[model samples]
Target: MSLRETVNSVDTNAKRQACMELINEDYNKLGQYKMGEVQSRNIMIIGRTRTGKSTIKLLLMDPRNVPDEMTLKSGTKDPQFQTFHIQQQEVVLNIIDTPGLFERSNVESDIRPDEAILKGIQLCANMEITKFHAICFCVALTSGINAQDVEAIEKLIAFLGDEIMNNSCLVITHCESKDEEQRNRLKLELEQDTFFKKINPFFKLGVYFSGSLNSDDYKHGNESLKNQYLTISDYRKKLLDLFIKIEKPFPISEMIISQIRQANDSVEQKTVQLEDEKQKNDELQSRIKELQEKYLKEKCLADDLRVKYEQQERLVTDSRVTHGQREGQLKNLQEKLQQKDNIIKRREKCQAQLGNDLKKIIEMEEHQTKKLEDNFYGRLRSVYDADKIRAVFLIPVRRIITDYLRYVITSFTVVK
Candidate 1:
């Protein structure tokens, strides 16, 4: 996830994951030896001038049972680096106590306090062994919320952005009130302010009411400072818990650098995406052209096929007309053939009738010839016994008989 997502949302797990990302990267750079080793973590202390950022830094290192080691010295003007350990955990802590945030000109140069702190945090990032774990914003409750305080915070937020802001906690310090009612009044004032709410939107991690670590000029045992200092034990423990909540420690400088590099990368990414889109659009246009040409060719083919179909239809119509005429002529020829068949049948009947008539005529002629032969035999026998008047007829008959007998005898002799 991006750094903006980690800080903009109210999800602790997201912020933890973001911290781990930088931590794992640092581990990679540290090499194989540090991979399994628990390395030291760092915390950045930031606040306006005289808000006791140095006191918080020292108290964290060692909850002071006594006053300042060197009484003459006041607040640190330059970035101070210190290392301390917690008894509960084995991890070491490197504190980067940034010089107070304000308008003070640098003693050696014209650099402002905010600019110096930026350089200091960058310096912390350069250290190979220590990574910034959490940030602590020191606030003096006795002053209540003021515009000057709000201005200082806005400057810090502008410098670091939300990544540093979200991982940070507001430390309410310098509460001199001894009575509960007085402390409640301070709390009520802080609660009503819009600026305090803006900073501590998530959780109020640490508040120092009893212990006050002031400049060397201010006596350590002053009742107000003493009361604030007495709260140091709880602050020390709770500050450790806040760092633990961060889960992994990474340099704030790394986050700033990463975000800057991402902007540069987006320019290049945009160019590549545009080129890819243009290539895809060109391919689509080419495909559409091919389909359009194919459609025109198919349309021409369809037109030709339609013309041929119309010609075939005309031919079929002509053939049907011709077939109808041929069928009519065939019917007339069939009628003539039927007439010739009737005439042939009548001729065959007449021929059969003529054959039967000829058969009857032949039978009648045979019967008449037999009857005439019988009559002639009877007449010749009767004339043979006739008297003298028939003598002449008998003489002729006898002569005829003699001649017939002679002819018969000669025929018989020729036959023998």
Candidate 2:
């Protein structure tokens, strides 16, 4: 066989040996109860971390191994098994002490609390030791059962099934320090606790207060210490007797195992889904950031364009104002030109009237000259009859005609 196969074989053998040990322990302890036949009474002890689960197991099954002082750290990291035999009655008690439920570990290699619990139950079930005579749910009395304890109890029930409580009982530890009145008050408080009341129906054997003293305290202590130790021992015996009195054992069926397997698969699927959703959210955020940057760039561009447009508008308005001033100057110049054209038209009209008046005066002067010439000609004819008289009249008439013609010529020139 190969090395891998050999290792696997060894592992299988070891597991079988462990199971056999559990079985043999039960058979040896309860042989007489079955009328000379071998039988085992299996009991499962469960509780939260540091609730004295392992300590309770040691004190009950092997008192000699009980520690002198309680350790602050957890004792059981995995499932453990022990068997106790009552010498007189020839009875066996097979006990499986499991790691605490809901235990937090800083170590990365440590198994999860729920996984550890399932592993412990599976281990016991593999031995065909499915039936449990008693399922002792341990709690520290000093802690006084809080919400975490209640949640742990609920988780245990979910794993093992509700019927496990049929043979289950509450085991309150650290009761040795409490006085009678204090113990009574604590019990009353437990009775009022919501979880306790809820599970009260299945707890036929009810709750048990378990306490233990170290060997040193028992042997060398004072009277009161010894009495307390004896009382604690008696409580342990009563717990054992309760296990013996159970008529039926709580069975761990295949259905419960199948349910646990399904639950594990569901948890894995949910983890994968959560990772996918987170990735999608990250991508969406990145896209949103990109869009916001683009929007800002566009807004800046728009603002620049608006400023340029306003500048251009101002330039156009100034041009329009200058054009209006030029138009007013042109209109004034046109009005002056129109006034000069009217004056020129009036001067031309006056010059034409003066020319007409000068032509009439010239015509009058010509008429007067003609009439005077006619009168002189007639006198010359009369004087011609007498030669001397005719000569004198000719001289005077010629002088007057000359003077008057010259005057008419000067007046016409001046008028032109």
Predicted candidate 2 versus true structure: per-residue lDDT over 1-416, tens digit per residue: 99999999999999999999999898998756565544568988888778888777766764444455666667777787777776556678888989877676776344455676676776686666767888888888767677666666677777777877778888888775566677779779877988777656656568887776645565666466666666667777888788777878888787876666576568779888988988898898899999999999989999999999999899889888878888888898888888877776665565556555655655565566556556656776676654554467655665686677667656655654
Please give the RMSD to the true structure for each candidate, in Å: 32.0, 17.4
Per-model tally of clashing residue pairs: 9, 3
Worst 10 residues of 2 by lDDT: 62-71
| C-alpha lDDT of residue 267 in model 1 | 47
Candidate 2 residue-pair clash tally: 3
The positional error of residue 278 in candidate 2, measured at the CA in angstroms, is: 19
lDDT tens per residue, model 1, 269-323: 8878888887888888888888888988988988888888888888788778777
lDDT of each: 0.61, 0.73
Native-referenced Cα lDDT, model 2: 0.73
